[model samples]
Every structure is written in C-alpha cells, then in structure tokens.
Target: MRLNGKLAIVTAAASGMGRAGVARFVREGAKVAAIDISAEALEGVVAEFGADTVTGIRADLLNPDDATGSIDQAVEWLGGADILWAHAGMPGPASVENLDLDAYRKAIDLNITSAALGAGRVAQHMRKRGGGSIIFTSSVSGLVGSMMSPIYSAAKWGVVGLTKSLALALAGDGIRVNVVCPGLADTPMKTGFTGRSGDPAEAAANEAKLIANVPMGRLVQAGEIADAALWLASDEASFVTGVALPVDGGFTAR
Candidate 1:
C-alpha cells in the first residue's frame, strides 16, 4: 500500500524475483509495465494481472532499442513512471577455462550493458518528474568471488558498481538508486548456479548446507526479496540511496 498511486516499470518481470516484485507492486496499488524476454511468460502475467494494472512487454534487454523502449512504454502506459526495477540479467553457465567468447559477451550484454543503459535513461525521466526510485538487482555473488560461476559473479559485482555510481550521481536530482543483493533464493536462477543436480536426495542435502550457513537457517523466499524491493521503491525507504540492501538470511554476515 505504500506505493499507492505510483507507476512502476519492472524488467525480468516474468519470473523469480522480478515476477514477485511485479505482483507485489500491483497489489500495493502501483500500476506496472512488466517486461521480460519470454513472450509466453509475459503473456501469462498479463492474463493474471489484467491489462490495466499490469501489462506485459516481451523484449531482449540486450537490444538497446528494446531496453529504452521498455522504459518509454512504461512511462506512456502508466501515465508517468515513479519506480523502476532494473532487474533483467542472464546467468549463462560458462567456466573461465572453457568459456566461449560469444557466451562471455552475451553475459556482458545482458547484465552490464543493458542495466547501464536503463539506469541512465530511466533516471533522466524520473529526475525530470521531480523524484523517483530505481532499484538494481545485484546478488551475493556480486559481493564475493564465486569461482563456480565467474561470468555471473563478475557481472553482478559490476551491477553494484553501477548502482553505487548512479545513486551518487543522481542524488542531487531527487532520484534515488539502490541495489538489492539476494542470497541463495529459491528461484530458477538457483539451479544454474552450481549446475542442476539430478539426484533428489543430494540436491536436498545441498540446499540444507546452503541454509546452514545463513544465520536465519533458511533460504530467502522470492517474496522476501520482493518485499525489500517494495520498500526501496516505496516512500518508506525515503532518505535511502546508493546502498546495497541484502536479504540473504545473513549469508553475508559471516
């Protein structure tokens, strides 16, 4: 309810944290334009949320045009956007030793390039409107070196840098920027983190170990991440910017 009367644009809006954020935003009374790369998933969200409160746009953020276009349409459709969740990113499995040049570039395109473009462009609009909030989805990988997924971790770390600089630069303009670092959340992205395990028992054991490290003794739920996202995008987090808020169940505490 904190976002009542605001309009939000959420990228990666078809699934996981992004999907949860879109739903939370709408439920909190914010109209949202949900963008995702999957046409099928996007259509499904539109069907569930209806066209008025939440609409869907399927586009690859790697395409510069589409990245900017998502912002434009959201601004247009919702009558002016006050919140932007720059959440589109890819987690391609590539080892440093065997990583293909193409895959590495694709990671850069999706994670770093697209996020930078959206941050700059969306900030311009939000600034002109007097004020707004933008939250970038970073990760626990961004905080520490994860050899298991070098490309993804590196890209997420870059997101922290992007969010930090953007927040500092836009502070004067009344536009707030921040980053959310989620730790070991149960999302599709989780499976790819260490490669999918075929054995059910081993996978459960692995999951348990991950939770053991967290002080909270549980993996973060997507809604928990969404709620953090919601507060950052809401007036409740006023005076907050340029910080990476971790909803990691204390994974980073140790």
Candidate 2:
C-alpha cells in the first residue's frame, strides 16, 4: 500500500502505460480519476476497475480547454490529487521529408502543450494540499535523436525541459516534477506504427530492427514503465524531483 489514502489523476488512461499506472496506483490504495479521449475505452476502464476505484473522464488533451478542464474535474471528483501522470501522446509523422506543418503543430500540442496545461492546473490544487507529484511521459527520442520523427523528438524534448523547470518552480511548495523517457515499448503505439507499412514482412522486419538496437533485445513492457512511475509518485521518492528517468532497456545508456 505505498500510496494508501492517496488520490491520483492519470491521463491517456484508456490503455497502454496510462492504464497500467492507474491499475498499479489503485492496487497500492490510491483512487484514480482516469482521463482519456476515447469515451468507449474510458467506459471499459471504469468497468474493469469499478467506479469506487476509478472515475473516467473523456476529454481530448490536445485541446487546451479540455486539458485544463479535465484536470480541474479530476481534482474536484477526487476531492484532491496527490499525483498526476500526464501520459497522453502520439507518434507524429514518420519523417521530416516534406513534413506537414499541421502534423507538426498537432504533435507539439499533444506531446508537450497538453502536459503543460494539465500540470499548471493540477499544481494549483497540489499547492493547496501542500505537495504533490507530477509525471510526464517522454520518449527515448527526447534524450537522444530520432531519425524517424524529428517533430516527435522536439516535442518530447520540450516535455523534459518543462519537467525540470516545473520541478524547480514548485519545489518550494513540496511539489515534485519528473519525467519518464521510455524506449520502444510493447504497446499499441509501437505495433500500430510499425504495422503502418501494411506488409507483415516489412512490419516484422521494422520491429526486429528496432529491437536489435535495444541492449536488452526486447521491447520494454508497459508494466515496467508503470513501476518506475509508481516509485516516483510514492513517498519513496519524497526527496526526488526534476529527474528524467529512462526506462529504455539501455537505449539511452549508449
């Protein structure tokens, strides 16, 4: 019960790392307000966790109003929030060659701006309660460089920068801000993106190529990422802040 009696908000909670975080937190005795853009998927989460343990909120984080409003709603529903996991993001265009500016803007909004807006609103609530934890999801591309998606790399890099700045700004109020930079994970995002080629052989080859780059030779599990987040959000990391921890199977170590 590491988070016994705590309350939390997890965005992108309908699936992947966000859903895993919600489950882990709840198991540790925290009630969660799960926010996602998918109404049907949100309903599924509520069904899986039960209303007593999770409240589902449907809102598109890419919209500034939805981003901030969802945070307010979550805080209000949970009475207060002790943790926030801003995990909503998308893999943008595959390359910069003839890049669509509109796609670039959308990537920035979803990958970084939403986290900023959500964190800003949640920090206000956290201040009233004395302290809290804010976690953002970045990608290994943020720490290094990604040839596949320069726009995504830029946006995730922004998330790391935001986390560090917010940590310093909110440290005095006992708020801890950190980010998790995950490598290629065994999630829909990864498989779906690789499968975009629509050729099984090509998709498999692409996946194999990505895996070969990881020292561990495997995709990082969503549960593993959740465990990292659990520690950061728990009292165990009370003195920790402003760190960009990588759960990338040694991808960044190289």
Candidate 3:
C-alpha cells in the first residue's frame, strides 16, 4: 500500500479522474475525505467504495469556504489530513469568443482559487506537523496551447504557477507541492463533452478521431492517472516538488 496510514481529500470525487483517485487512495490504505457537488453521484461513488473505507463530503468547491470546510471536515473525520488532491476542474461548452463570462469565472473559482484555499489549509496543517504532499490535477491543455480552450488553458497554467510557487514557499516547512497533467482520458466528463454535440454516435466517433491523434492510439485510463497521484503522494517522491508530471501517454510527446 503506497498510502498506508495516510489521509487524503480528493475534490470532484463523484466521477472521472477524481473518483478513480479517491478509490485508489482507499485501496492503497489511505483514509479519504471525498468531495463532489452532486449529492446523488457522490453517494453512488461512496456506495461503490463501501462504507468502512471512506467518508464522502458533498460540497461546491467553487466556494472557498467550502474548500476550507472540506479540509476541516476531513481532519475531523480521519483524525488528521496528510495529503490533498485538488482534482476538481471543468472545461467548457463554449469557445473563447463565445464562452459565457460567468462560466469562465466559475471555472476559475473551482479550478484555481479553490486549489489555493485547499492547499493553504493543507500546507498549514502539514507545516505544523512537519510534512505532507499536495497534488493538483492540471492538464496537458495547460502545458501546450489548445486553440479551442483558452480559459481552461489559462486556469491550468495558473495551477502550474501555483504548484511551483507553493513548492518553494513551503519547502522550508517540509510540505511538497506538485501537479499532474493528464492527457485525454476517457471519463464521464470527457464523454459528456462529446455527447453534447446532439448526435451521440457521431460524437463518440468524433471523440475517437481525436484520440487517434495521440501517439499511443488509446485513451489514458483513470487508474493510470490515479497511479501518478499515488506516486506524488508517496514517500518515493520525497525529493520531487514543483514539477508538472504528464500522465498523458504520448499526447504531449508529439
């Protein structure tokens, strides 16, 4: 168990990469405090994981108070928080010129600001305790330009900056901060983006076409991303910090 005896909170825990990471954390012997905005979906994930291993907290991460609240709740539930996975994020149904301003704000609220709030609390606790690991779910879209997604790209880039800045600021305190940049993974969220095109079959085919461009010629599995998070949270990465490790297969390679 890579995370034996550790405590972690995974935001956006209802589904996709977040859900997978939460489950893997539990399977690796970590006590997890999982958060999601959807009550029903959150319950489903909790049910799937069984009751004895994890505690599910449903909350809107867009609210910084809620982000801070989640940390406190996790500490109360699990005795003490040692790892934080800021995995909550959203792309869009809109292009740059046409995207709703409010939607973009919401993305920033959920993606960037909430991460800062959550990490701040986690760092404080870790600082006092002498050590901990913090992981952020950034994207390849942030590292390379995505002409179709400006706000998401901007927000993800902010995550990279945050990871580096926090890493330096907290190095003296023994807290390590890092970000994971996942390539295209086939998750409910990714599926939904394609399915939204109004033609289900066509949308799926379209998604396939996009995946074919990757050198690996396959979608990155949820578990694969989870494994990266597991490594980041483990002592094996003791000397690692402020790095954006790409779990994208070969998407960024080309």
Candidate 4:
C-alpha cells in the first residue's frame, strides 16, 4: 500500500485519467475526495468505490469559487490532504484559423488557471500537515509543438512552467509539485478531439497519423498516466519535484 493512511483530492474525477487516479489511490489504501463538475458521474464513482474510500465532490474547476471550495470541502472531509491531482483540462480549437479569443481564454483557464488556484489553496492546507504532493496534467503537446492546436500547446506549456515555479516556491514548505505530459492517450478526450472532423473517415485518418508518430505504435492508456500520477503522489517520489515527466512513448524524444 504505497499510500496507506493518506488522503487525496483528485479533480476531473468522473472519467479518464482522473477517475483512474481515484481508483488507483483507493486501491493503494488512500481515502480520496473525487471532485468533478458532473454530480451524476461523481455519484457513480462513489458508488463504485464505496463511500468509505471515495467522497464525490461536485465543483467546476473553471470557477474560482468552486475550485477553492472543492479543496476546502475535500480537506474538511478527509481531515487533511496529502495529495492533489489537478487533472481537469480540455482541448482547444484544432487550428489557429479556427481559434476564437473567448475559446483561447477558456483553454488557458481550464488548463492553467484552475491548476494555479487549486495548488495555491491546497498548498496552504498541505503546509499545515508539514508537506504534500501536487500533480498537474499536461500533454505531449506541451513539450513539443502541436500543429493541430497551438493554443492548447501553449496552455499546456504554461502548466509545465507553473509546476517548476511552484515547486521552488513551495519546496521550503516541504511540498512537491510536478506535471505529467502524456502522449496521444486512448481516452474519450482523444476520440472526441479527433472526431471533431465530423467525418468518420477523416477522424480515423487523423488518429492514424498521430499514432504513426509514437514509437510504441499505439495510444497511451489512461491507466498508464494514472500509474505515473500514483508514483508522483506516493512516498516513492518523496525526493522528486519540479519535474515535467513525459509519459509520451518517445513522441517528444523525436
């Protein structure tokens, strides 16, 4: 039990990597507050994991009030938090020509602002507990350029920068901050993004093109990213901080 006796808060916990993180953390003996904007989906998580191990929190990370309130509520329920996986994020318009200023701002808000607010709020609670770990979800696009969506690439890059800056500022408080940059993951988010072409043939072609770049020759599973998060959140990574760890199957290596 890598996380025995620990308590954690995971945002976007209703699905994908965030939901996987909740399941993995609980299996490792940690009680978790599963925060998501979807109350119905969150209920499903609590039901699946049992109330003893998972507490479902409904909050919109894009809203500052909801973001901070979710952390406060998680701390209240868990007694204290030892880990925070701020994994809520979204893909922006596929091309710069399609970009709208409002959409661009929303991308930044979802990818970076929410992370900053959550980390700040969680750090205060963690400092009282002596130390804790904070993890953010970036993308392979963060490490390299995304010809499809430069805005998303830029926002994710901001996340990596934020992780390093926060790591230094919070180190004296014994808190560790890190980000995970996953390569073309096999998740609904990926499917939906590719499907935006609105033509099944084109969508499949797009996916194939992206996968052709991965040296592993396949999409990275959501669970694999969750596993990386588990390592960062557990005592196994006690000495690790300020790292933008890429679980990108050699995409960035190219």
Tell me the spans in candidate 4 whose CA falls farther than 4 Å from its real position: none
Candidate 2's C-alpha lDDT?
0.92
In candidate 2, position 230 carries an lDDT of 96
Q: List TM-scores for all candidates, in order.
A: 0.93, 0.97, 0.93, 0.98
RMSD of 3: 1.7
What are the per-residue Cα lDDT tens digits for candidate 1 across 33-138? 9999999999989999998789888888989999888888778787787999988777765487876888888888898888888877888788778989989988
Q: Give the TM-score of candidate 4.
A: 0.98
In model 1, the runs with Cα more than 4 Å from the true position are 196-209
What are the candidates' C-alpha RMSDs? 1.8, 1.1, 1.7, 1.0
Q: Could you arrange the candidates by TM-score from highest to lowest?
A: 4, 2, 1, 3
lDDT of 3 at 75: 78
Expressed as tens digits, the lDDT of each residue in 92-197 for candidate 2 is: 8777889888987888999999999999999999999999999999989889988766788989999999999999999999999999999988988885457656
Candidates' lDDT values, in order? 0.86, 0.92, 0.85, 0.93
User: C-alpha displacement of 155 in model 2, angstroms?
Assistant: 0.7
In angstroms, the error of model 1 at 210 is 2.8
For model 2, the stretches where C-alpha displacement exceeds 4 angstroms are none
Candidate 1 global lDDT: 0.86
Candidate 2 deviation (Cα RMSD): 1.1
Q: lDDT tens string, model 3, 157-245?
A: 99999999999999888899999998878887675445555788977786787688788888888889988999999989999999999
